[model samples]
Target: MVRHMDERAGVDPRRTDELWLRESERYASTHPRCLQLRERARAHMPHGVPMSWMASYFAHPPVWIDEGHGAHFTCADGIRFLDTNVGDKSTFCGIDPEPVVRAVQRRVAAGSQFMLPTRDALVVAEELARRWKLPSWQFTLSASQANTEAIRLARHATGRRKVLTFTGNYGGHGDEMLTAFAGEGRLSYLGLTPAADRDIDVIGFNDVGALERVLAAGDHACVFTEPALTNEGVVLPEPGFHDALRELTRASGTILLLDETHTLICAPGGLAEKWRLEPDAVVVGKAVGGGLPLGAYGMTAELCEAFERGESLTGRPGELATGGTLFANALSMAAARAALTEVLTPDAYKHASALGAELADRLEAVVAEAGLPWKVQRLGPRSGISFGGRLARNAAEADADEQPELNALLRLCLANRGVWEAISTAGPALSVAATRADVAAYVAAFREFVTDVTGTG
Candidate 1:
């Protein structure tokens, strides 16, 4: 059963409320410039921010970043922060990485887009193929678009309209991918048509029995999943989970699509490569373009050949729905190529991994010292503290373990101390450019927060 905040041991609601109040005041005092900018922005944008999600995701008024260099960024208030959030993994290669910046500058001077593929496109595609082991590749502006296209292709290829996705799976915000399980039925998020849940099935992340039962019908075109659930929290797959997943999908003739946009932090080639899991196709994005917008999907040779021939598994010819005018534009292609080749190299991953391990260790130590019932979970260079005694095995447990008030207070405290982390839904991620100093700074700030909250100083 899920435990409420007040029901959890070692956490006092009144103390949490008091700390939240203190942190909120501290945040307001230190962020006057951000407040001023937000007030000005409110005249045009909702909640005084360009994006609706950004408006309420932060603990205080949204910080206006003047510039970012490597693992740090200066807010409008002139305070520099160790940016563990890394633009929510969009800038995982680090802010303004030199290689990507140089490549983007050159590409911009040459013309950003031409509705034509540049030589960099070939280089980027070839690199993606080499990393993910897929022979044919395509590009999109975001992972959401890539997932949408992948689903469409899967439906076309298999002549099946049903899509299977695990609970807490966040590939993208595409319509069909947005539905979640609600009791015996499923419900689509707001703004989505009722038909969004038409043929989509939602199951638990590591439930082999549920998986077997669902795929038994052989009606699903594809089973889209992440190697490990990251968005809800880092829910690692149980032993034999991946094996069962791959085997079931194959026997059922369902297209197995692995979305590694976030899991790429797991290794140079992402979890798909790290675990040697076989999939019909792979989708990646986020850090792929450094700080630019880019998404890519790769397919096996057989899938590509069948797609090119416009033939489904049953040899039915159909009109293909893919490609966009601005897709694979020159600027994005150049950024992706430089990011993969020059910025996010093997050495870079090694550096981030070392710091990530240290950060996780320090966080665990702090939690233990505080006598809190929290557990720290790590996935390569990413680590998150779950407000539970043990690691979550599925999305439901992760959701049950969430402590929103505590998290908000923690984030506000960290921001006031010159450390920035991702939103409540995300954990801290060390970028390729992060240094040991950055990790140390984060640990120090976190320790202070824990001491204040637990009164253990």
Candidate 2:
């Protein structure tokens, strides 16, 4: 017998897989153009896309997009969608915001890049310092680069060989930050030498006692983390968690490195401002560039001084992990300056926060009314829906509560009705351009899906 969608506990694995396959087949059948493109492109690319993860994101081939603008994009097959995923928060200000577009256009006409430096770079750096309350800043081409460089800086300043990171929290694709705590104190790593793996210490998020105990060893150089957990699920920090994190790291002389790529949705100044977190170093990317690729790492006064003083942990000069040739390129600097000063302003955040709350509240109401075992949560302009009723306290709980089959079914349902969300997490990020109607449309589609799946309409 088929089970109700809301029946999650002790769910039949085979049934879930079957349901996902059904939806996947349906998606492929409807989009013949997508299928044709997929076959044709496979001759050159491994999975008919530039990236392999794109193919793995959906059970079916990824949808091809023709054009995108504020809050929406048209698929290659001509289907338009309310894009809540917002390029995984890479376009949180909205696709092609006029300010960013004009900045790029104007700068490109003047010049795109110059290894020496550009005036826009200084302006962007100053703006970031003002927003984040940090004194020194450096630019990179991506968040991964920023994070990797931050770790190197932390090690150089502290003269330590090991790094501490929470399980299920992703810092970036850097080899050192690519490890996860696989529950029960077991750690797993990817594409790193055993020596590099050992330098990474994995622990559970929100476990203050565990964090303190680990740092007490005095071998860790830094604790890299997102202010609030995301991707695996939106597990928020428990009360007093940030305070404890700050206290432990400071006492142990471990640099606190925060990756705000996703948690930038927490507020105008990101989670650091919202929660009043004072990390030694901070990394930001994604929407910071307003669609252009850019990343930045900011440092406190002491950390900056340490780097300049050549205070390497091992008595060796620190390598230049800070930037690349195109890091502070003219075009990216102009785009970032425009995004920070004009597009992602206080007014835009106000709109985004309200819409985020509206989407979360409406979805939660639907679940509550239907008496389903589901919950919705919002962090400023970001929101997520999870399977269990109560919020997850940590990554382990969040992982256990995930409903992949439900996620696939809902994704397909929403896509069919003109909504698009992040496939990895099914999280929605409200853009500055998102309207009340967009939120309403998504909520209505979700309500319809819940009623249909649960047979409670």
- Root-mean-square deviation of every model: 2.2, 2.6
**RMSD in angstroms between candidate 1 and the native structure over all alpha carbons:** 2.2
lDDT values of the candidates?
0.86, 0.81
In angstroms, the error of model 1 at 32 is: 1.0
lDDT of 1 by residue, 124-151 (tens): 9999899999999999999999988988
Residue 3 lDDT (model 2): 34
* Candidate 2 per-residue lDDT over residues 170-199, each given as its tens digit: 777766666543433434544565455668
Candidate 2 residue pairs that clash: 159-313
Error of 2 at 393 (Å): 1.3
Candidate 1 pairs with clashing backbones: none
Q: Report model 2's TM-score to 2 decimal places.
A: 0.94
Q: Give the Å error, residue 394, model 1.
A: 0.7
Give all TM-scores, in the order shown: 0.96, 0.94
Superposed model 1: Cα runs more than 4 Å off? 1-4, 7-9, 181-188, 314-316
